[model samples]
Target: GDPRLQHISQSIRVVPHFPKNGIMFQDITTLLLDHKAFKDTVDIFVDRYRDMHISVVAGIEARGFVFGSSVALGIGAKFVPLRKPRKLPGEVIYEKYSLEYGTDCLEMHVGAVQTGERAIVIDDLVATGGTLSAGIRLLERAGAEVVECACVIGVPEVKGRCKLLGKPLYVLVEPRQVDQCF
Candidate 1:
């Protein structure tokens, strides 16, 4: 199915110097504030995977939670959180990856995804694809098959590093300048 990038593009706000210097954060908070926009973002994912058998929806830390949970609810699938280091309460499988600012780690609950479960990883954006790669590794370690990845936005320049080639990628929008705010 063809994804609609226009609506998602219109809803995002480019914020400069967020979290630190030289980083242009793609703020989806503005999109979340609008009901229609928020629903559209979720709908895009739901439509894309309507025919696929998705048992769980895994969202990356922080921002990914906002959209991932909504998509999970919309599609009637379980929601799993791929969180920051030491965030998960119980036993977790961890993976470390580099971020735009510095190095960081992501973790998932020990039993978040059962063996052979079909899962989809969701995030707000994919820049360097570091976070997404970490999430994929963690899920695979837990014995889940990652069917696809969904993001609100994709920065192709960063993805060109060859981190996201074999995965089926779906994005609501792809901005020309992912680091413009920096």
Candidate 2:
């Protein structure tokens, strides 16, 4: 309904061969620096779920924390951090999944979401769908009805969308082409 999506797309910085060769790393730090763009991104997400009866917002480790917490605050829901092993305190349930490089695990506190609470999982990007998929499994196992998985960006070329196992995925934007940075 507005130019917020364009702002988000423009604020991201694409780095060539980051963390490895042949990888175009999509960076969002630039977006964070642009207060308006950042706020709009969160507002867009909040608007989507504010009235959906979402009791919880499950944010994946790292990037998800940025937008997820804001959305939770805006929507009046609890924010749960789905973290790496040993990051979450007390009794936690974990799910291990394979990524392009290796296998990793995500852990959430056992009581983060009570039985039947509606939740939405957030991540910065969906690359290969491993991280979001694992988060969904972790939440579902604990009896949370994951409303949907949301990401700021999606690399459809990686086929992460297909690996979601029928869960709805919402992305703000996909690169128009591999060569287009914004």
Candidate 3:
């Protein structure tokens, strides 16, 4: 077994037909339950960005919060959340994007990131990449320089990385992308 991925991969529960038919969900809840696996996952990111001088850690809503906040704390950067519409209290900026199923939007506080600040967008995985792309767009509109995007897993067959349009992608585990499977 590959020591680097053995524990982490094992911790991820592959649930078939989740949320819909013919979907294989890479559930990280099981990974979260394994303290060592979870810490190792974050450590992989922390060690990579600790010295990169990233000014802001922009995490996508929900799952992104878990790893993004931890990485922010480790790197001494502020954690900015890209949330669903109306989830933020103050004035916010939003971006509309297309998901595999339908279109949705992401919102961030007006001043979450300062002009020219370096930011890294975080999400658990990159399947279709629309959501991450939207977050990057929103940050750029706010005048932030998005340094890159980070995820634990990458679904490359979906060509999600291509949607970034030239931004660097940092990921730990890259399973073969199944085009038709969710």
Candidate 4:
């Protein structure tokens, strides 16, 4: 990882027991607040992909949108948003993946990605790899060759990378875990 990424790693705020128990949530909202850190986060991604001949950058909903659009612009690739169900109004294709509780789906507009286009998926964090896997499947099913998945933070202990089906994953920071001290 780049030395500058240290700042990116430190900027993340970890919240314990978020929406449940014994779960440490790696939050990037704090990173979004620091202008330099935020810009650096996007810059690091842009620099990595700018020379890769990438044609499409698919962001996995909500948080992925933040970095994806900027990276697409910087890399001269088209930005494609893989959204939640029914969030897109046009013709779409979707892929569903399992979660700890239930299943969730990701939708992409039909014809958003051309056949044989090289693409990457961006998100803020990757935990279970379920959502990222669905995003890759959605793009691959559309005939796009998914080149990689990128994220700001990663939780290695959860082994999210195992679910990506051999697709490469890149992360700027490995999360720092702290006990729930309140």
In order of appearance, the predictions have TM-scores of 0.87, 0.91, 0.90, 0.92
Tens digits of lDDT, candidate 2, 1-182? 46778778888888778879988788888789899989999998899898899999999989999989999999999999999889866999899999886899999998888999999999888878889999999999999998889899997663223336578888887643343544
Candidate 2, residue 106: how far the Cα is off, in Å: 0.3
Candidate 1 vs candidate 2: the lDDT winner is 2
> lDDT at 66 for candidate 2?
92
- Best prediction by lDDT: 4
Query: Which regions of candidate 1 deviate over 4 angstroms?
Result: 1-4, 157-165, 176-182
Across 1-182, the per-residue lDDT of candidate 1 in tens digits comes to: 34545666767877667767776667788788878888888887887776688989999989999989988888888999999988778998899998656799999999778999998999998877888989888888999999988888887654322336367776666653443322
What tens digits encode model 4's per-residue C-alpha lDDT throughout 93-150? 9999999989999999999999999999999888788898999999999999998899
Ranking of all candidate structures by their TM-score, best first: 4, 2, 3, 1
Best by TM-score: 4
Clashes of 1: 0
Model 1: colliding residue pairs: none
Candidate 1, residue 137: the lDDT equals 88
Model 1: weakest 10-residue lDDT segment is 156-165
Candidate 1 lDDT score at position 182: 21
lDDT at 57, model 3: 97
Q: How does candidate 2 score on lDDT?
A: 0.86
Candidate 1 lands at a TM-score of 0.87
**Candidate 3 lDDT over residue span 117-172, tens digit each:** 99999998887788889999999999999888988888755323433646887766
